[model samples]
Target: MQLQQWAEQAASQQDWSTALQLIELAAWQEPDNPQILCRWGDWLAAAGQPEEAIAAYQAVLEFQPGCPQSIAAWAAVLNEQGQFAEAIALLDQASEQTADLWHQRAVALQSLGDWPQALTSCDSALQLDPTAAESQFLRSKLRLGLGDWSQGSPEYESRLLVFSELRDRLPSFGCPLWQGEDLTNKTLLIWGEQGYGDQIQFVRYLSVLHDRWPETPLLLLVSEPLVDLFRQLAIANLQVATQFTFETESAYDFHLPLLSLPERLGATADVIPLAQGYLPRSLQSEIRLQANPRQLQVGFVWQAGETSDRRYQWRQASKSVPLEQFLQLRLQVNHCQFWSLQVGPARQSLLQNWDWADCDLADRMHSFADTAAVLNQMDLLITVDTAIAHLAGALEIPTWLLLPKFADWRWSLTGSETPWYQSMRLYRQAIAGDWRSVFEQLQQDLNSRPY
Candidate 1:
């Protein structure tokens, strides 16, 4: 096979290292080939070498100015780096227009909070290619932001296509995906998807599903860490398990992803399953509270799980506050006992100046169940956008969710309240990346409340 052919084969199989090697060999043989350079650039971008990829794309532009492929790929890398304006400019300069180019432009515009324009660009792309999953998913978020849940929830199903990693993990049950079908005597397998926060947020749909089919047996498959916590639902016909066994397959007649339950059940912001609390009281060991008159117990989680992906890394940074800020807040409040509900390497932040009154449950709290138990003892919970926030909300604990300027779509824009969790209150940064104002507001609110 020719060097270029071999490289294409390797790329098809997702062997980035081998693909890069073959592309390098092909480039060496045909030193001035713009196509080879573009191939090299694409592979480099896929491997997360943005700088090297840009260099290769620039080389292609030098040989063949305004090359559509190089321009689009280069713009994509810039978008990944949060240079939305520059990416938009580059896409506009492209000589050719394609569905992908418009989609990339829409993504950049969306990042800049240009929702109307982003929606327009996304529609243009979707009109050209209706099967473009990423564009469809982006449109769904835009629609949701506008509170058009009727259309948004249905379009959101494209997530299975846009996030290939998530789609690949979905098990094939050899049965049709369960819509709102008759299940008087049937069994349904409800499997988990996305992050812990998403699972917690959507699990409320199960109660509705149970009510609709009171006689139907519902088998829930969740991550191991959540299995114990979800069991608290205690639905009479529902069984919770970490994984699905082949022996149990015959028991279920149909299956559905947990997140998909919303669309299937026609859940809207106004008509979401409103409940005081969904999770049952956790029976796990709880941290002992000190006997002090006029003392308030508070729990806080500052950081999310560590990630190397640039997208998630940015999210983690945006949601997290420096430990110094939390300490300052603790100092400002009187007779308040702060508890560390943060886990992973982020928990080390608490060791800087250990206070005896502040209970540290980092070592003891293992799963969502353990965290829920600790939250049960607290008067209030303060956290960033993480699973703990969702858990507290699910448990009907008073929770203050600190949000960045460009918050997640679920929280919506311009709101102190959320429809998902009635007990949860949102505190957003007036300016992007500014946590001081949020903290100040939180401090003021705490000061006004009776201990």
Candidate 2:
């Protein structure tokens, strides 16, 4: 017990190595203790050792059969390993019914594209504990996946409570959140949230906001990287800033996150304000294309930006494809000239060997503005689920987006098209984490197309 207390203290202090060591020692001292074994499993899972964590959970379940905590924790690790069916089966066997177990079941069902079942599980969980923000958030995503945006958009507010880090980073203003209130002659500040792709996708709503409140001044607080790209909107009475420190002298009246615009305007999948492109076309760059003029000028992005957050790690891994896999497309397709639209350190590593594409823009694209300018020259854009895909979709470029089997809610389930972007075509993986099948289908489609 003393060792476990010391381990908790060490963990709270962020000394994970010492905390893990302490937990291991405590487990050794009390081998048959389910509580100790569960704690050891949690530490192992947090340490990115899912296999070891699964073993620990299995040990706990052996001693205490059908333990709700062990079952829920084990199911979560199984889901992370992409064993959704197995996770769901284990969740079904849990003797104790708890909100957490229901939530775990909901997640596993959602991953398997069982939206109706997932929503039912979410409802069951929420009925038990209405304040379960994570379940509510998942419910919102399930609703969106099922194209019930009227319900989903309103429930989406639970995200702030669900993702605590996002809530912590949010700039709080004493002003009330804008909820379709009259903004006549009043200033409204709309701030960006989440990833760069989210900012780019939702920025189109600014035009809708501007149109509604033509007389009202609109202040957009966006990320530093996107500041330059958003500046080109040039909406009357609109201002863009990278940061906002709420002060008495501030020019805004009401503040809202960019995503909340959908709920405020009562937007659904059917009415996603500005279904076509919204961004102004960038002036063509002086950079010359080295590709054959007769062939299709296609740009491709293979990976998303790297992140340390465990919540995002699995999504990033599933979405990203190896550079070697894209090289196969180069070898198979001869009608199109491929251009590397990839940015960041990953691009640098891919460009080291240097013999795949006609031109590389890794050194040139520093911001979204630069990438937008380059994307303008391409006839077609091929990319994974990344910011570049959203950028291309926003620009109204003909974009082919490659998606994993369990893709984001925005792409929805069982579709080759999204209502968000008219020019974008989705190519989804037939099996989870199988990029080879996606690429093979993509090659066939490219060959059959009249480009």
Candidate 3:
């Protein structure tokens, strides 16, 4: 059979082993064929044999020097093997040989966490082929990582158009942004986006916005559970809209995603204004009465909703743990009530164990609002870097956010505190995915305190 025919049959059958074998047979017949070598190398990499793939691709480069495809394939395998610098060097050579080389270089640099260089490559790729779909998509993602939102937002919108649901979900605003000036006589709809934690974090800016434009009709659209709590915010002209049940006719003059407030505020590493506390008055009043007479009331959220790590497939596959680690910490606290704000599957299992330190909130709670109410009542919240952490931060409740070693950038690095929340204290893992050390330090901190 023809090499192409064999390759096509193997691929169509979903037999990676057979495809690899066929590619090797072809390469053996035409040992100096750069094309065959590159194809075989790619199949090897796809079959999770990056080391072998790199060797095959290198053989191609030996015969035909400056082979861009082989160079790129070698770089990609090196990247997969965690040899970022070597991969980047290969990409540099590949990039010089082709007009679309920058696109390949960007992929290599992104893997190395070199966002700035990757952005430059993305720019070069766009300049080379402005209409290219992959160039447009990657450019947007790299720009977001670089924290360049001025251009990022428009690019994001453009990229989102590729997804029918995302495109449809976007409101027809007639404009890309709100000036905050035209709000004098119009209703401004401020709604949530992204994860629950994102919604909670950005919601704090709503109050700042309300103070900035008191005369504008502020209709805050949030998930149903947050409605009752947000209604009590009681800013002048503040109105609440929950879920899909709200009556509306897109008559608003402007709309903004709540997450965009950070961009509008020009929030930066040094400028995170940590306002001491900002929980709603009604909720505060309720929590104040429930505060224990003798102990430092620290609310605890051990596990984030399972959805938090769903996007990181490799991480999910390798290292995921339950609240058993949390139970160990609970034993160290004598007077503290270890409340479980952990939602979803983990919560049920935790309740079944019935290991909570006589804490009754787990029995009474059913939704996020209940969790929010409990947070308001507590003096401090000890939680994983989850939605509860964002909620506590937005409410300006004193919260100690626990983070994994390789944390998301929103938390930033080299800090014991968050700029977005004055009341938040950060406890991070010293090593990647090492929660035991983090938990040990937290335990010591709890022990040192007058519990």
Candidate of highest lDDT = 2
RMSD of each: 2.5, 2.4, 6.6
lDDT of 3 by residue, 1-451 (tens): 3975798688677688999888888888888888888888887777777778888888988888778778867865665554667867777665344434666677666654566777788788778777655556667666654555566545654544544444565665454556445466777877766667767666666777777677878777787767766666647777777753455544566777676665565444344443554546245323323456677787776665543221233322222344787778777877665566566565666767755635535644544566667776777788876777777776777787877653554654447866668778888777655688878888888778775
Quote each prediction's TM-score.
0.92, 0.93, 0.67
C-alpha lDDT of residue 428 in model 2: 90
- Model 3: lDDT to the true structure: 0.66
Better of 2 and 3 by lDDT: 2
lDDT of 2: 0.85
Better of 2 and 3 by TM-score: 2
Off by over 4 Å in 1: 12-14, 169-171, 245-250, 282-293, 306-312, 352-358
Cα lDDT for residue 239, model 2? 77
RMSD of 2: 2.4
Instruction: Please give the lDDT score at residue 141 for candidate 2.
Output: 90
Q: Per-residue error at 137 for model 3, in Å?
A: 8.5
Off by over 4 Å in 2: 245-249, 284-288, 448-451
lDDT of each residue in 1-451, candidate 2, tens digit only? 9999999998888787898999899989999899989988888888888999999999999999999999999988887777789998998888889998999899888888788999999999999899999899999999987889989999999998877666875556667788889888789988898899999999998888888878888888887789879888858977787786333346677989898998998777877766689887764556666768888889988898777765557677788888888788888988888889888777776667657533677777878888888888889999989999989988899999988898888998878888899999999989887788888888898888765
Total residue pair clashes for candidate 1: 0
